[model samples]
Target: MSMNDSWYRASVGDVTQRDALQGDITTDVCIVGAGFTGLSAALELAEAGVRVTVLEAEQVGWGCSGRNGGQINPGLGCDHGRVVAELGADDARKVWQLTLDGVELLRSRVKRHNIDCDLKAGILLVANKARHVPELQSWQHELEALGYDQLAFYDRDALQSLLKADYQAGVMDWGGGDLHPLKYALGLASAAEAAGAQILERSAVLGYEEDGRTVTIRTAAGQVHAQHLLLAGNAYLGKLLPWYRKGFMPIGSYVGATRPLGELATQLIPSRAAVCDMNTLIDYYRLSADNRLLFGGRASARDAQPNALRATMRERMALVFPALAEEDFEYLWGGQVAMTMSKAPVFGRLGRRTLFAQGYSGQGVALAGMAGKLMAQTVQGDAAGFDLMARAKHWPVPPGAPLQTAIRALALLWYRLQDSR
Candidate 1:
């Protein structure tokens, strides 16, 4: 296969296809990158009677959207306390509510569109270290103070009952869940197309020019002139826009799928909750609808696959479920996540008619799709919620790729050290 194959691709049934852009076209809104964010935005815009076009460099969900751990987490990549400290109580509350809105938006879309993506309904945030228990407690308390209380704390005993993992403690959030990400992406694309949106796969955006009135996007096959533009490509945007490159570091995250665990799957996670650890670089895993143990962790500044990727992942799995140490891992893949210095998503206008959202860190499964809806709302002249997210601070990455990589390595090393303690 030309692309890094994923278990998701193997398991999903037939996918919808749209022809590539053949000639120049005009649209009310033009979106680049047809992943969750772009498709979600396109669906909302098309439903509202707007002419929208989505350009994809690869197949829909070919990026991290399809390869993620499939955890539909509620909050941003950072902790709630950190959010309040950085964005302040008022703005932090607004952002928290946006996450809640994101979860609701996902649930509503899945139901309204009748999208069957194996949608599950719970996520367990477990502590990797005993020292992290107090931090988890603080997080639960903070969310409750903000009037959002869907979390149920779990002691070590409770965690062991549900997950045979070496976790210290955990909190289960009924508000969060997991799903088949690629199926969800395809479902959104289908819904968008059904609403009259045009999606052109294999149509990579070359560049664009916005003359205040309208933006003209040039691609290999065609050009698109639109009154507004949405750059939803995230880490895959590359150098298509120079300024955007400075806002986020594209880091590689790895995931693996095991052979079906059969009855052992239910025994491991009896409640069938998606689970993640609390370290800066954490381990996340869930049982697939087919009973495979899909586990993900490990990160790299470069795109190079880790030496012995499957072996390392299997070792990690053994730590969680020693009974499954011999379980055969059938799939190993990695994808880039756009991580910002602030660990908050970067959202704002490029000039006047151009808008973009990226740096979802590693929590893009739900938030990215919701951001697309927020982008659609912004295009419709409603920018309240979008602006709230755009208000979060972002620093430009240093000019050189080598320097940026080194800085990220140093920063991640420090985080790893902290996690070790």
Candidate 2:
């Protein structure tokens, strides 16, 4: 397989490439990064009759938005109880509501825009080990106490009915689902463009200068001066925002798509729901519309060694379904997800006029889009939700990239060590 031959790209068919920014431009809002967050923000801003300009370093959805597990899983990367402990009751509830809004926002946008991304409803959190089942039970109790009844617990037998896997038990979340990520992203982009937003592909932001009044963003061939700016770049943000870089760690996750499994697909996951394990290093997967199994999981914090990634992912898949051992995976890809120290998203102002939302950890599919919506609202003079997010604290990473990488490596090693014993 080629380096970037992802299943999402292959399944989405041909995509029209947008031209890079070639000259100076001015807009009401300028957004850097054309992934889900950026495009979604542009959509909201454009719908409100605001002149929005979106600049992408690569094509739209070229980042983790295009390369995720496609699971519209709910909640923060951490447990709700942990959130309550850290943020206190009222703030935790508010933040939790934001995530729920994120899920609804995604569903409504897809419905209103008629996005054909093969969206299906249902997600199961399976336990790979018996000890994890009790943790899931605690999670269930916490959610139930919080009046969230969308989740239903399953014993090993009941779970087997939904998934023919070697899992101990599972919890089914009706609120979560899966979709064609790249297609959904492109659909958002199209909707934003139709609503009067200018989207420029391959137009990377070199730097920016923000005054209290207007912010000027410099690109290679052009510049954008806007009343407000958004940094929705997430893991790919790089050194663009030096101060913001330390707030999160860029961790790589890999995915592989198997050839169409025909009737076997239905049998593997009878409910056809997206599924993931409740582990620090999670294994998530869902069936494609054409019956391919899009399996994905965590890799190292660096660019993946394709052959090694494929082997490890395939081995993990086989553990869940021994029958797939002989199956051939046709596509393989990976992308980085930003993980904040607290495992919660970071949403705040760069200065006063520039707002940024990122560090969704691994659950960005729904939340990142919602974060975008919140950013749009802030630009429109409504900062209720955005302010709530900004209150969540974020810690800086170690200074240098090498030091950061070493820290992440040690963290992953510690997690893996715990998982082993």
Best by lDDT: 2
Tell me the whole-model lDDT of each prediction, alpha carbons only.
0.86, 0.88
- Over 283-328, each residue of candidate 1 has an lDDT whose tens digit, in order, gives 8999999899899988777786644567777888888889987786
TM-score of each prediction = 0.96, 0.97
What is the C-alpha local distance difference test score of candidate 1?
0.86
Q: Which regions in candidate 2 have their CA more than 4 angstroms from the true location?
A: 1-3
Query: Which 10 consecutive residues of model 1 have the lowest summed lDDT?
Result: 1-10
